[model samples]
Target: MSQDLLFQLNGVSKSFVKGKEEISIFSDLNLTIERGDFVAIMGPSGSGKTTLLNMLGGVDQPSGGEVSFDGARVDNLSESALTRWRAHNIGFIFQFYNLMPMLNAARNVELPLLLTKLSKAQRRKNVETALALVGLSDRAKHMPSEMSGGQQQRVAIARAIVSDPKLLLCDEPTGDLDRTTADEILEMLQLLNRDHGKTIVMVTHDPAAAKYANRTLHLDKGKFVQRELVA
Candidate 1:
């Protein structure tokens, strides 16, 4: 595999056993994601978009075939190993800002660093840097409930990046925000990819949200139906 390739899903398949029936979601699906690239995945409900994202992040494994990250096989890892790998290599953003209401912005952002061996002072420095990057430095002391939707999402983004993960897997990151705020968040994501070299894979249903990415792919009925390149 090329060093530039961040993710590869080769002949991947997934299925669930529903009351004696084996329901297949996808079969022989293949994908490749390169470093520093921003890609958006659009699909209808039950089309396996989120499943594919989870597979990429090692949150879920393919029932068949290979899932590789940075040239290493991820699908075969044990749960403990996968957890450690995800902590170091994957940052995740969700439609809802999954922040702990009791924790302030800085503390929320610092949660990821607690998994590492970094000192308290270093962790605080990293948290400050992340909050600053997301333009939330001034709101670091605020609780989640105290901030606007957009600001809370920014804090979530800060938390995601605080660990300096190699990949960001976002699932409808701006889905809960208003149009203007969504655009602001999208532009921030664009800046992350363009200027900060953060490779991002976002799954969104909205066409406008997909436009922010450099490349977009549509999935339907467990297969990629079309792909578009954004200028």
Candidate 2:
């Protein structure tokens, strides 16, 4: 692995036991993502895009080889250790806006702080700043049902970034939205990547959405087949 790489997967492989058969998703896969890179992984259904993202985010372990992050071997960490490490270093954005139905926007964004040692004032400040960053400051008190789908997704984005994690993994971030709403969310994510220098890895099937990334990696049959750098 190069010294400057933020993520390195060398000869990585993943498999699952289904019934009486062992299904292999990836074999001898290798990849590297540098700091501040906004990369999109595009693949057809069943191509293991989400699985790869989960592995990179420390949500799942590779069956063979190594997955390292910032010089640390994350694939070897214990489940409890990996959970703590991920909470501190990784932010995950899913297709569905996974917000607490009972919590308001601000309180939802503050959920991650419960794992931290920050005081109440500090947590509140962080939540406020994150909401403002996503342009949802005015909706801080709104419940999930009170907002549009786009607005709720923005709140989810705010919650993801409130802890200021080093890496952001997004899986189909705009999947549930209409074109216009999806475009707005993409623009916000691009701003976060370019302006704030957050390292982002997004998995999407939409070419238009992938255009926002600095590079698009095409995966076929669980292997990276091609890569395109877009200006």
lDDT of each: 0.94, 0.93
Q: Native-vs-model 2 lDDT?
A: 0.93
- The candidate that wins on TM-score is 1
lDDT for residue 120 in candidate 2, whole number 0-100: 99
State which candidate has the highest lDDT: 1
The alpha-carbon lDDT assigned to residue 70 of candidate 1 equals: 91
Scored by lDDT, model 1 comes in at 0.94
Tell me each candidate's TM-score.
0.99, 0.98
Q: Which ten residues in a row have the lowest lDDT in candidate 1?
A: 1-10
lDDT of 2 by residue, 81-102 (tens): 9999999999888898898999
